[model samples]
Target: MDKKEDKHKVAEEPMEHTLDCMSRLETMSDEEWNEFFSDKNSMSDCSFLLGYKEAKLRKEAIKPNAEKAWQHFHTSYIVPETTRRHMGIWIYPLATIAAILAIVFILKFVHLNSSDIDVSRPFMAFTADHAPQLITITEDGSRPNIIEGRQQRDGILINDKEADFTHASFAKKMIRSIATPRGKSYKIILNDGTMVLLNAESKLIFPTSFVGKQRNVRLIGEAYFKVKHDTAHPFIVQTEKVNTRVLGTEFNLRAYPTSDTHVTLISGSVIVCNRSNNKAIKLCPGQDATLLGNKDFDITTVDTDYYVQWKDGYFYFDDLPLVEVMKELGRWYNVDIEICDNSLLSYRLHFIAERQASIDQVVENLNGFSYLSATRQGQKIIISKKMHLKSD
Candidate 1:
């Protein structure tokens, strides 16, 4: 034979030996196996076997049909003598790895095929004319299936079979938004067990699953959060003007685009800061922080219950201004408010009214206590100072 042919023949010998050794693993005596592993020349071959075992264990842990898939692979692919002889024993482990990967792909394919559609896509889409009361938006901006969540005592009940947000594949960095339109509210339990009460005319943008160093969510309008504490990963709430950082705490944040952003600490501690100015204020229980514009933050001691009372089915106002009260009412009742008399804006009111009450009922209740009357014009409500009749 030529020199090149001899070189090729020599290279094939070690691969043949390795494959021969691997195929005999089941039948080999313990002493023979030990001797094979102990041999310095067989170190590379033994390493391949150990790596394959590790991969097999991992597949078994995550995939229920891993063993069955392996058996099928062995029968169809590994038992073929032509493939083994041509590819050689050194390639045997690689072939097995490929087979395992194929099993994973098949399993994923089956899972996707079994479902009606991909629920991992975004929630329902909203337009200027049409807005869903409550919807979730996916990462890619696609609206997926609209799940009608049922309200529970502690949280909302979403169909668990629709999507598993906590799965590792879904936990990767992906943006999602859950929103509530006017006259509606929603409660949700996140993958990390954090409970959030979303108020009307509010939207929260978060990851379907939080990955990386920090768990973060962006909020518009208002929400009351019962954050899940993880010392290793800090939870962050980002608004238009401020970011609230907490390890684990109960707090309320209101950040309407047209109004000032407010943060009220209910329990534990939080660091509220503006990214624009880097001005941060640490809030203790019973303290409230308001971000005025993008430059100034006002922190003061306030009644925490008054700020978060909307989540408890009551609109509890303590000396809140009439304009502010109307704004809150309008949001819940899905009405546009126009104050006819500017003097009535200065009227301060204190009352606890059920949120479920109609706008007419609320307006009537207010007129009984204050010198103002509200008139409904279609979806708009006009409030003015009540004109008294002169003595006839």
Candidate 2:
């Protein structure tokens, strides 16, 4: 019979018998499975069996009969060569049986464990090993109250702790602060439902409640904002060099003191105003506006993915200068990167790496390039150009 006819014949067999064979295969020993796979002659048979099992599975949503899928495996895959020749029963190759068994096992495992998955957890690109601090700033400049894991009804939550601002004594003290140190990032939801993801070495200060017409927050480093829609109470973010005002929008604001202020809009709309000069410019989605000292805004259309991927758990670089790439890595890893040679700074590269990866893994990937060399010493990363040996 041809391959089609063979598959149909197997499918026509009693479902109980097919299931029994699977149960036995699940119980087979590792040595027996290795022996079947090692037999080169049985390769085709294994493929055929695998295809048959997949077809049957697609036709019916049948669950495996075994509790522990692997425990039910058996050694009925092959009979001795002499016993098969003497008996009338057709001998099926062990390799095919093993392949079929693997498919059924995987299906069963998935089916049984599906309910254990958590669906409500939010996805984050990276989490700092060190926790950020939450403090309430008083007008008197007294020692700030350091808040940790606690939650209060109708108040803000920091880490796990919640601050009760409803009390009369603390209600007047509206200023609250969240500070993220090097190698750490923090996330918080303001009273107005605005979600902010604070980047490393960043500080955000805002009122405990939105009592005024404008909801204002001051930012120091880098942060991603998802402002809640409130036309009456417009949201405003004050950076060192610029102020971003938005009704309801998602955007990333990079205002590190050492770098130029950048506002990259992801959705809705925003107006960026230079702090030095009140000149303002409107930005639409997929556009980046940078404030250059006291000059007018420099607006440019950019790939939004490159700016916002940091919050989603990745370091995305698209033909960026190697020096800029190292600078970003330094912020999240809490390390200083020193370029021993200036020639390597001009080299542009496109790279993507998981934010949670270790610094060692990052260095290893950088060294993979033939012309670049990277090494880690204590908490510092040293970069240098690779010297190639001339072939005579």
Candidate with top lDDT is: 2
Q: RMSD of candidate 2 to the true fold?
A: 22.9
Q: Taking the tens digit of each residue's C-alpha lDDT, what string does model 2 give over 1-392?
A: 99989868765554435454455554667656465445654454545445555555545655544434322211111111211111233244433443454546544664553222222222111223344433332323456655455545434334432223333134554676777767667776777778888887788887777777899999999999999999999999998789999999999999887666789999999999888878899999999997765587889999988889998889999987676677788778967677665435456778899989999999998998776888888777887767551110
Look at candidate 1 and tell me the lDDT of residue 163. Answer: 25
Model 1 Cα shift for residue 73 (angstroms) = 73
Runs of candidate 2 with Cα error greater than 4 angstroms are 1-147, 151-154, 160-170, 389-392
Q: What global local distance difference test value does model 1 have?
A: 0.67
What candidate 1 gets wrong by more than 4 Å, as runs, is: 1-136, 149-171, 389-392
Provide TM-scores for the models: 0.61, 0.61
